[model samples]
Target chain A: MARIDLDHIRHSYLRNPVKDSDFALKEVHQSFDDGAAYALLGPSGCGKTSLLNIISGLLQPSRGRLLFDGEDVTALSPEQRNIAQVFQFPVIYDTMTVYDNSAFPLRNRGFSEVDVDRRVRETLEMIDLGDRANRKARGLTADQKQKISLGRGLVRSDVNAILFDEPLTVIDPHMKWVLRSQLKQLHKRFGYTMVYVTHDQTEALTFADTVVVMYEGEIVQIGTPSELFERPSHTFVGYFIGSPGMNLLPVELDGASARLGSRVIALPGAMKSAGAAKTELGIRPEYVRLGREGLPVAIRAVEDIGRHKIVRATLEGRELAAIVPEHGEIPAEPRVTFDPKGINIYADSWRQELVA
Target chain B: MERTRNNKARFLVLPVLLLVAFSAIIPLMTVVNYSVQDTFGNNVFFWAGLDWFDELLHSPRFWQALARNLVFSGIILAIEVPLGILIALNMPKAGWGVPACLVLMALPLLIPWNVVGMIWQVFGRVDIGLLGKTLSLLGIDYNYVQDPVDARITIIVMDVWHWTSLVVLLCYAGLVSIPDAYYRAAKIDGASRWSVFRYIQLPKMHRVLLIAVLLRFMDSFMIYTEPFVVTGGGPGNETTFLSIDLVKMAVGQFDLGPAAAMSLVYFLIVMLLSWVFYTVMTNYGRES
Candidate 1:
């Protein structure tokens, strides 16, 4: 295991990268602790895969220091970095048997036949593909082939880190869940430094110990799943991490209170400064209460999702989603209230710290 | 309504079947008829009852020509497949260069086969051709017209130049179809360049390679125009493949009975070999 550090990493395809927009990956400076399961979560083209590629030495950053275990490794190749990666689609040798596919890296590195067999067998058992060991990979289904790809990465124990780039996209929903659980178990058992990239919030939250939410070529926040859900550092994070996502309402700040349209809502603490340009109040759907009290809302639609009902309504002429329990009643005159602790104030799309 | 719809669908296949019958079945029937009979100059014919086939089977010329055809096809396949793959691998993956490279590759394939032979015939001459002059300047004696070895080498090289681009284009299509995720996966696995080529690129290119091999083999086996143009089946039959021999017997010599028999045998050989190639490759693909 190794603590991988990225110090001021930035990359651009063009020869002269002058401005922020020119870069595929904006400046990122962070460290992943040894044995930590980290996720680089973002929508497509948000530089998550680029960051992962940089770490794996498939790409070199234009300007940055990549340190592995406090030693400079920016110039190292992927082989030198010792990283295992499973792709979005399976990348197995179709002509080779499952056993050979899984044992490829060990054999390439000149491991003894006994050692190769032992490791390959253990990985096959771990992936529950032991019975198909002798079968050629070309005949396997997509999911099974992907498992072989995963097994190939996992068979080598000497690797410093394992990276997964949305490796379950092709898997069926039920199989995806099963594989996700299996991956989680394998991570627990092995304690290898793992970095997974995914656009799916559920996969990111479920797989990683620390979820690194990215937006537009930059890392917005890196925190535990609960921290991200409860206190998102950026409005994008708040909007991205939830199913219906968080509602950001334009607001005028006044010290410990903010006015949303015609109503004044009390803030938990004082705002340090009203920031430039865009100012809004962000809150998750779960934290927004809907009843016969508080600010008036014009209900547009109600979605009954079995366990909970999501009320889609217009608040001060802006659409907002609020979650209510299945048994909760809808009032004839519907109103909403934001939990003071759950409310977050954003200025210029950045979170503003609250002053006690 | 159901009966009418079924009748309409059955009618749809009639024209296609008729087209196949006219184009393929008719020629095949003619060849079969010729193979079984002998004809004199005044349009009078006699049933030979496989005598021509027996003669062809026992002839040393037939065996030698078949051997030459096999060797030529084998050589062409050996040179083309890997060379094509290498060129495709080295070409620019993206940008303005891609279309330019594609156009350059397609130029040779667009030229007529006889024209290609004429171009090489002129290009390989000792007096006016740049290649001959350059070879002479480099202190080498090279003459396709007078030397059998030189004729064979020139023909093989000419075929490679003309047809290898097709293989390259096919392999390039296969290469470009590979998603970026596969390369990323290979990098993460710390796969060496050779491993990546072996495990990912080669397996993904299996379907294209099979097509290339089949096309190159059939074309090389049936090659007659280019060698006939350059060497004229010449320098004492050293470069005379089966097609050249068959053409000489049928057209130059006008021995229709033996020629028809040879054509049938030749057609059977190509059909049997093609079927064998297709069956073996497809079955291997399935088993893998």
Candidate 2:
């Protein structure tokens, strides 16, 4: 129930780190407002876990101040911070009964037995484990154990935030969907400031109100899911966030037009002084229109993914994917055209703002 | 679906069958045969039919030895299990200290049992041994040769020294296999140090601790070498455990019938107790 501010946080595992690449988390200066749901999304080894740990105080950053509701908590331990974290693997007390497992946090905090029992019963009911209150946690299934792990946090009434580190990795596919929606419902019900870390785009997009995309130890872009889909600030976000991710074609910019080999595509607005090398035009496969009247292209493969077809084609010696409807016609002399609104101009792998 | 009853694959077990027969079954059956008969030397044998078993059971000396064996095992377990867990808990979890600690802990287990006994035997002598001389100098009556209490204590200490490393090693194996996430989660739960050990660590160590307890129990109950070498069942037969007394009857007194009867009873006792321990511990470790 507090806004967490990770102020200029950077961490390196080495005792004495020298170079910038030595850091696991490069400067992370972000704030999660009170009661906001955020997902730190990135590939493996991208410092998503490091940032999450910094928020939870499990890891003390090598250089930065962490604040909870404007109070400096950088020096505080996780216990002192009163944060709850669910790890990738379920961490349950196997010797305890389901009731005691959920009641562990409150018991540790010296809550009265009656209070603990009442709170634990409520939590067990919430997690659908009410009947298993007296049963030992020994033989529960993976999803059930993970629910206990989640219930450990909800038993407490004073935790600042609940941090999840890929908590659904070991769960079955159907259980994953169930637990995910359960987490969303919990977030809405409790209004706890939750920060979820995952590499799955669907999990990130659906679970969090704000998705912070990271790449190579830095925050590449932080935006709403649709905003990220439409306007990717970094090329990594453009490539990493979508399923047949955004296609990047090397282009030369002239006035408001981008020339890929010989053909030119008009831009929505003129690029200002975005003088840079290695310029590419980024476009989503969903917006790339393939018809009989635009630039000539050789179609390589068409994948029917039930609802939509992904048309993989080579344009100007570069491969690109265009999404077509399931029953859409593929013209014999197929040519491709970019939807004017979907065109994003990048310089040095960073999107440039157009001078409107 | 019907399972094919192929008798051809049944013969494949013959080598193991012959190996067990030659190694264990023959000796065991011979002892059983001798227990049911009287031997008057020169291969002269007569049907005894449980007479030896009845006499051995009625003998106070045999009962005393069995009692001594149980007491020794109980003391060893009570002392070693906790002590081994303490040492393993204190051992360094990482860095060069880990290897150094492990090597030092494993040193005692590498020594042969009789060698360990011989070392402690000399080491506890009142006149020249370091421990006994030091105790005598400290105004203590510390002689294993004439004092039954001192002899019993010496053997117990020697066994602890020799085998507590085994318990430590097994418990250490159990402790390290636990993922770091458990500790982290416990910390976030605001668990006290004792709570962490009780809930997280002790439960995780259940499987290996089962092995350590069963091993230490069986080994201590069947203990013969170390005490035999150190105290030699002296001080008025006080330290004479079941195995030592059985060996004395068979090898020293040359009483084959009584020895074989005692051997069968001893083997069954060990087997029954080990089975009980295994079943109880495995059920306790049913979490995973």
Candidate 3:
């Protein structure tokens, strides 16, 4: 295992990329420590796969250096770097048996037959394919084939890291959950540095110790699951992570508070310099308090989704959503209030910290 | 729930069945009818009871032609399959080179078979043709019309030039359909080039290679047009395949009984060989 570091990596598919928009992956500088689980989370075309490929040495960044355990490996191939990668689709040797498929890497590296057999049997048991060791890989189901692919990665004991690029996309829902838990267990048992790339929030939040949220080819926020939920550093992160995402309202900054249209709300800290064009107050829908004595809101619709209710309302000509309990009271005249601790002040699409 | 079995929709297949009967079954029945009978003249027929089959099976000329057919097919397959795969592997994977290579590879398959034969016939003339003149200038005795070995070589080269593109095209189609992930995984696994070909490429190309082999086999086995135009079964009948010999018996000598019997035997040989090839290959695919 190794601590992988990316030093200002950037990539562009075009020959002469002068504009910032020409790059597929903009400047990214991050470090993944040894024996930690990381998830690169983003929407489609947000450079998550590109970042994963760069880490695995399948692709070289056009502009930066990559270091593995403080050794420069930017020019090395995937084999020379000792990396393993699983693709979106299952890739196994269809003509080989399950044992041979898992033992391919070991045999290719010139291991002895006894060693290859022992390692392959252990991996097959780990993947729950011990009884299918003699079966041809072509006859297996999709999930079973993917497990063989995972087994191929696990059979090698000298790999620096194992990367997965949405490997469970083709699996059924139940199998996806099962394989995910198995992967987590494997990570814990082996302590191999792993990087998983996905667009699903649940998969990212549940699988990784650090969740890196990305938007428009840039890393917007990197934090734990709860940190991402409570204090998103960017409006895009707040909008992308949760179900009924954060409610962003335009505001004008005062001395130690912010004014939304005509009403004023207490701020966590005084704004140092609010000279930006767009200033807004960001709060999650779960923190929007509904009562009878706060700012008046024109309720548009309310939807009951089993455990909770989503209250869609209009405040100052802008739509906002609030999550209310199923048994919570909705008065004839509804009013809303912002929790003091839940309010986040943004100057220009970036979060400002409290100075107290 | 049980599906409704309707008998009214069964009549929709009558038109296709009649078309097959008129086009294929009638001519086949005529051959079978003539194979077991004799005719002297004026629509007079007599039941000969397999006399023609007994005569042709014992004939040395028929056995020699069948041997020639087998050797030709074996040599063609041995040379063309590997050569086509080599050319396909060297072709560019992407960019403008793909279309350029495809067009160049498809050029030979566009020409008619007899026309290809005529081109080679002139091309092997010692006095005027480029290939023959070059061989003559190199102090080599090269006369296809006079030497049996030269005649066979010329015919084999002509067939290869005319049909190897078909194999290349089929193999190229199979090669391109392999996803890039397989190559990436192989690279990560540190596989050698030979292992990559053995484990990944050859298995992927198995189905198309079967088609190419069966096609080249049938075409070379029933070879009539090109070699007839080029060699004309000359030099003591060294190049006379089964179809050429059957045609010589039916059209040149006007022996209907034996010719019909030879045609049926030739058709059966082709059908039996094709079945053996298909069964062996598909079973191999399933087992491994």
Candidate 4:
């Protein structure tokens, strides 16, 4: 419904942030396209919630301009900006029935009784709480209360954006899945500009069309799920995305070959040192090939995880993990090789494009 | 967990039972014994049966004191509860002002009961005190010692000044415990100031407010020290309460049987009122 633009936004809880480290959110300049589902993904204390709050206008940035649909709304409140946010915990008016709870936002915006009633009923049905329209919100379970929360946001279809701040945290696992799928369906049906903030990789990967990965107080990468898996822009992204995460190994680069310990391995592509002080090779565990060839590794353990086996090994004193298909043979002497497509080179922890 | 069925473990409570007998049971039993008998000088006693209770129940003086107690408690609750809630709502929620406001609200409650009575008694003197002299100069004839209305007003104001802080402190605690998300969500939902208070803040403060109401009710009903010191149940017993009347009956008149009977009735009244109130409030909360 609205394209949100963050122009060099920076925030700090302190009155006077003397240094950059004092800021909770470092300078960030990005624009989210209208009608696109984006997830702000990061670990705890990584400033994801701060960024979400900024978007919702619940928090004003210490510095920068926020534009909604090209209109500067930096000084506007959440109500003025017409933003709806679902918090980590379900918030409901304990005295109001589910129908009235969902109708609150609509009624606040001066909608007529006929319109409010129609929209509330439609949203309640969408959230699978249609039968509970007459029940007071106090005695509802966590998930049902969360659905009522979702219904309030959904009732008003013309809002600028709907934001979610770990809204499924109190829900059970099975309920989380149901609510997430319902949210996806709503997003697709309405084309709402949704920004979900979470530390969960699976949720971000599946729910978002574009995932914005953040670390410390800055965004590390913004890309699609496939793009992030194949081409990570920062070492943090590589370490944060996958199940076992990408294995990083220190290497010394020379011409087109990198030396690990006393052995030299041919690089898949050319390297540009550019006076770099540190270099490492990054690769996902799914692409790590273990066979009877290439560099020898000391296999420490093999864990059978149903569909596949995870080979835990030590290669040149560096720990590594490789996934093998079910029933795959583990050679008497195991050797590991990197898939050329999975190879990523980092210069000072920033991923560099390997020239083919 | 495995259940431990040790019969000998029950004997560990012997010390507590002995302590209770010394602290609560023995004194209550003595009062009961006095209530059922006629006592003379030098401990000469005779069986009175239910005669003391029947006489006290029929007396208009005893019924008037009970009515006065109920009226005082009702006025105190009506004034203090709303005033405390309003002050708490207006108080600053953060920064240096929080501690300052809390300490200021707590000052009235920290004074000794008799000291509060003494302070107000002197402070309301028509010739020498600031309030009384100022009221006299303003052409208002406010003589607490001579006028019953003025005397009752002084007692009620004194009680309000002393005890409203307990309510404010409890409600403030309740207000702070509410998570920040609820406010943020309310704002996003475009709730007006009145709606936010009615829906969010009031519901959150429900339990603490119940405690505040019950405590203020009981404390105001059993009030004795301050009013007793200020009015001495004077101005024709205008400020006399149940506790004050019972004290006068036992200590001033030395009528042990009638005083003990009155004490038993007063205890039952307080218990019955508190229980009924708690049950009604809790049941109302549970229904929705």
Candidate 5:
């Protein structure tokens, strides 16, 4: 395993890339430590795949240095970089047996016949495809073919990292879970540096040690899953990471007190003085207390999702969602209160760190 | 109700059946009548009863022409399929170059078959033609009009130049249909370029390759116009394929009974070979 570093990586398809808008990936400077599972997570067209391709050496950055184990590998091809990739769809040799498809790279590199067969068999067992070893790949189901594609990547042990570009999109949901668990376990056992790119939050959150949330060709935040959920560094992260994400209410701040519409709520510290302080308060739905006291709200709807109820309401012209226990009764007149410590203040879509 | 619906469907197909029978039955009956009977002008006929079929089957000319047809078709298919694939692989996948390349390839296919023959005939002559003149200037003796080897080379090269574009177009269509995600996956697998082509591109191109082989085989096997125009089955019948030999018997000799028998044999051979080609290819496709 090697520590992969991206230093000020920016790319543009045009020959003369002049400005920021011309770049597909804008100024991404980050390092993935050795043996760490990192996910580049974002919506489509947000440059997550571009960053992944850059790290894999499939694409060259217009300006940047890519370091693998402190050695500059920016100009290397994918072959020279020694990275493995699993694509979105299965790409197996249909005329060959599943064993040959999985053993192709090893055979191409002129490995001994015994070593190739041993590695191919081990990978087949890892993917639970041992029984289908001799079957022609053309006759297998789509999911089985995809497992062979995955095994082809995993069969090669001498690689800097294995990159996945939404490899589970074609898989059935049940198989997706099974394969994801298998991948996580395999990573644990092998400890290979893995970089996965996906637009699915659940997959990114479940798979990676560090989740890099991206928006509009820029990396917005990089943190653990819990840190992203509780303290989203950007407004897009607050809106993207959770179902019925965080609520942001426009507020006026005056040192230890924040005014939301006509109601005043206490804060923990003095607000930073900046020109035109357009502050907003962010709070997760799980922390919002609904009771018979506090600010009155008009309940719009309630969704019962087996174990929990999501109460959708309007508080002083701002829509909010609050999660409560399914058995909890809604008061005749509902009032919501925010947890002071849980509330995050933002100015211009950036979080404002509080001084203790 | 279901029975009535089935009856209605059968009724709808009646006119098509009538049209097919009208086109096929009359000519087939004429050929059969000619094959079985002896005629001596003046619209007088006598029952010969399989005499012509037996004589035609025993003829050495018929067997030799059949052999020549098979060899020509084999050479054409072998050359065209691989060359087409190589050119198509090198073609640009997108942008203005794609349409430009497509138009250039389609130009040869659009030209009339007889015109292709005439063009090559004039283009390959020793006196005024560029190829023949260049060869003579280089002190090499190349006369397709007189030598069987030269005639065969000219015919094979002409066929390759004219019909290889079809295979390239078919293979290109197959290549363009593949999604980019598959390439991305191969890249991630750390697969070499050869593996990517062998595993991804070649397998995906199987259907088109089948079509290319079948089309080229049938067309090359039945070829008469181009070689007839260029070589005219000359240089001592070296390039007289089955079609040319049948036409010679039917039209040149005016021996209707033997010619009719030969035509039937020719038709059967083409149909049988085409059926074999189609069945084998589709069965292989299914098995895979």
Candidate 6:
């Protein structure tokens, strides 16, 4: 196992990248702990794949260095670094059987046939493809092929880390959950350091202990699932993580209160000085209580989402969403109150601390 | 629930049926008709009932031509397929040099076959040809017209130069269609260069390689114009292939019945060999 450390890594597809926008991956300084499972979460074109490629040594960084267990292996190839990568689309040798496909990596590294057979059989069983081991990989369905791809990565006992670039993109919805749980189980059993990259938050939240949320070629936050839900470090994380994500209202802060239009709400702590920057109060919809006396809101639409209802309304002429109980009564005119403990203040898109 | 069958879609195939009839079946039927009958003079015909076929099968000349055709096709395929694959693998994957290399490789295939023969013929003349004069200056006794071995070498070289490009082009098309992920995964798997070629490149190129082999085999087996233009099947029948001998029998000697019988036998051999090649290759694809 290896602890991958990215030391100010930056990359650009262009030959001459003068501006920050020219870089596909901005300067990223992060460390993946040994044997820890992490997910690089982002939207399309946000450089998560680039960072994964860099970590796997498929593409060398245009700037800075990468270290594995403090070795400074920036110039080494993927083979030399001993990395196993599962691509977005399943890649299998069409001429080989499923058994041979799993054994290929071990054989390439000059393992004995008996050892290769034992390891391959165990890996096939782990991926639940033991019964189809003799079948040709070319005739297998997509999910089965992806399982073989995963099996190939797991067959080798000496891999430093296994990098996955949206490996579940082609899997069926039901199989995705099954394979994800299987991967979690594998990680728990083997303690292999795995870095999974994906755009789906549920996949990231479920599969990763720490999710690295990225936006516009830079990481926005690196935190646990509950941390991301409770306190998103950047505006993009607030907008990206939850299902009707956290709502932010532009507000004026004075002492221990925030004012929006004619309504004033109490803050948990006092603001120092409302500097000449964009200020907003962020709160999750789950924390918003629909009651009789607070800031008045015009209810636009109410959606029944099985467990709870998402109430879309206009507060101070800005769109806001509140989660209410499914059996909660709705007055003709609803007034919403923010839970003081859940209020987070932001200045210029960065989360700020309030002084008590 | 069972759905009703649509019988009206059968008429949509009428055009294709008529086109195949005019293009393939009619010509093939004419050959069959000529193979089974004998003609003396002025449209007077007699049913030979395999008499010409028996005569041609017993003739040693027919067997010799058939052997020569097989040897030539075998040699061409043996030389072209591996050389073409090597050249395609070494080709630049991307850059300004890609189009340049592709255009250069395609130059030989663009030339007319007989014109290529004429060019080689002139180039090999002792008096005025650069190659012949240069070889003479090097003290090598290389005369294609008088020597049987030299004539065979010259024809084989000409065939290689004229047709290796087709194999290269087909293999190159197959090579480029493979996605980059395969290479990346191969690298991560620590695969050797030979392993990558054996597992990834060769399997992907199998379909195109089959096409290349089939085209080369059929064309070289019935080859006529190039060797005809260069050597004219001369030097005591040293370079006389099946097509050249067929012309000699039908046109020079006016032996139509034996020539038609020989032609049918040649077509059958080609069809049988091609079917064998196709079945072996596709079965390999499936069983793997």
**Model number with the top lDDT:** 2
Order the numbered candidates by TM-score, best leading: 4, 2, 3, 6, 1, 5
Chain B TM (all candidates): 0.95, 0.96, 0.97, 0.97, 0.94, 0.93
Task: For candidate 1, write residues A1-356 as lDDT tens digits.
Answer: 78899999999988999988999999999999889899999999999999998998988999989999999999998877877888888887778899998988888778999999999999999989999999988888888988898897788887788888898999999989988988899889888899999999999999999999999999999999999998888999999999899899999888888888888988998778654688889989999999978989999999999999999999989999999999999999999988888899899888888887
Q: Give TM per candidate.
A: 0.93, 0.97, 0.96, 0.98, 0.93, 0.94
TM for candidate 4 is: 0.98
Candidate 5 lDDT, tens digit per residue, A156-264? 7777898888889989999888888888998899998999999999999999999999999999999999999999998889989888889988998877778989998
The lDDT values for all models are 0.89, 0.92, 0.91, 0.91, 0.88, 0.91
Q: DockQ score of candidate 3? A: 0.79
Q: Is the docking of candidate 2 incorrect, acceptable, medium or high quality?
A: medium
Quote fnat for model 5.
Answer: 0.59
Ten-residue stretch with the least lDDT total in model 3 chain A: A265-274
Candidate 2 lDDT tens digits, B1-288: 999887998899999999999999999999999999988789999999999999998999988998999999999999999999999999989999999999999999889889998999999999999999999999999899999999999998998998999999999999999999999998889999999899988988888899999999999999999989988898889899999999999999888999999999999999999999999889757743
Q: On residues B90-209, what C-alpha lDDT tens digit does candidate 4 reach at each position?
A: 999999999999999999998999999999998899999888999999999999999999999999999999999999999999999989998998899999998889999998999999
What's the residue-level lDDT of A280 in candidate 6?
A: 89
- Number of clashing residue pairs, candidate 4: 0
**Clash pairs detected, candidate 5:** A84-B188, A85-B188, A85-B189, A87-B185
Instruction: Tell me the TM-score of candidate 1's A chain.
Output: 0.97
Cα lDDT tens digits, model 3, A23-120, are 89999999998999999999999999999988888888888999999999999988888888988999999999999999999999999999999999
Order of all candidates by DockQ, from best down to worst?
4, 3, 6, 2, 1, 5
Please report how far candidate 4 places residue B208 from its true position, in Å.
0.4
lDDT tens per residue, model 2, A1-356: 89999889999999987899999889999899999999999999999999998888889899989999999999998888998899999999988898989989998888999999899999998888999988888778999999998889888877899999999999999999999999999899989999999999999999999999999999999999999999999999999989999999999998898899988888887778766988889999998998988888999999999999999999989999999999999999899888989999999998998765
How much DockQ does model 5 earn?
0.50
For model 4, the local distance difference test gives: 0.91
Alpha-carbon runs more than 4 Å astray in model 1: B1-5, B132-141
Is candidate 1 or 5 superior in lDDT? Answer: 1
Please write out the lDDT profile of model 6 over residues A241-285, one tens digit for every residue.
898988999998888888999889899898665684798889989
